[model samples]
Target: VVDRLNLQAIVPSAQTLQEQSSRMHLKKLKTVVTYWATRQIITYNVPPLAFIIAANTNVNTGALINLYSDLQKVAIEDLFNKS
Candidate 1:
């Protein structure tokens, strides 16, 4: 196996790799918040365009968005599990 590869792989620092993971988490957050917001809009009988506009503009979905954004900021990976 050693002789098969001619190129070296670049390994990024954990912090840099964590940034990518953090972005993945933030995207998951947005999807979840959108789900909840859709439920609320259904309850309120608001137009569907309202959700589209707010999400495009990156407007706050009240407390849930704030809380999840903070969660994404502070999240860390488990030492033993890569997932």
Candidate 2:
């Protein structure tokens, strides 16, 4: 599941700039689905926090650990049910 995480946010600026130089361009961007798990306490009043970070950039060790921890809270049945 970790391997399946969409890491598109990590595209290098240089690469993006180069791509923009080409004739092709993105007309629309959309996210059909997104899944994230976090260990932080879940609450009824507060909403879950989901953030997308660049893969090429250095991810804070603490943030990465927290993400993995949160992901564990998701039940296997629930995850599979999403499909």
Candidate 3:
């Protein structure tokens, strides 16, 4: 991991990294994008959360984390049966 970090730092800049990322082979692109989207919480885990999200705007991040936790608290019955 340390070696990877060192090599990553050697990349010239953000622009260079963006260019290099295209060339880099990914074993699991979904895993990479999942992390980029914060374990998919900020993307699709909770539908309400996904609907209202806005970028480049200031808001309390803690509330989002708590909200995600609250939504994740599903009962077993909620999981097993549906209409």
Candidate 2: what lDDT? 0.34
Stretch of 10 with least lDDT, candidate 2:
38-47
lDDT (Cα, tens digit) per residue for candidate 2, span 1-83: 76886544333343443354342333132111111232121111112432333321233444544554455455344556777
lDDT of 3 by residue, 1-82 (tens): 6455553333244344344445555322311111121222222234322212322224444554455445544422354555
Best by TM-score: 3
lDDT, residue 44, model 3: 21
Error of 3 at 11 (Å): 29
Which portions of model 1 show Cα errors greater than 4 Å? 1-29, 34-61, 77-83
How many clashes in each candidate?
A: 0, 6, 0
Report per-prediction Cα RMSD to one decimal. Answer: 17.8, 14.8, 14.6
**How would the candidate models be sorted by lDDT, starting from the highest?**
3, 2, 1
* RMSD versus native structure for model 1: 17.8
Candidate 1 per-residue lDDT over residues 1-83, each given as its tens digit: 74674312323333543465466464233422222222321111112211111232244556434454344333432322445
- Higher-scoring candidate on TM-score, 1 or 3: 3
* Residue-level lDDT for 77 in candidate 2: 47
TM-score of each: 0.22, 0.25, 0.29
TM-score of candidate 2 versus the correct structure, residues matched by position: 0.25
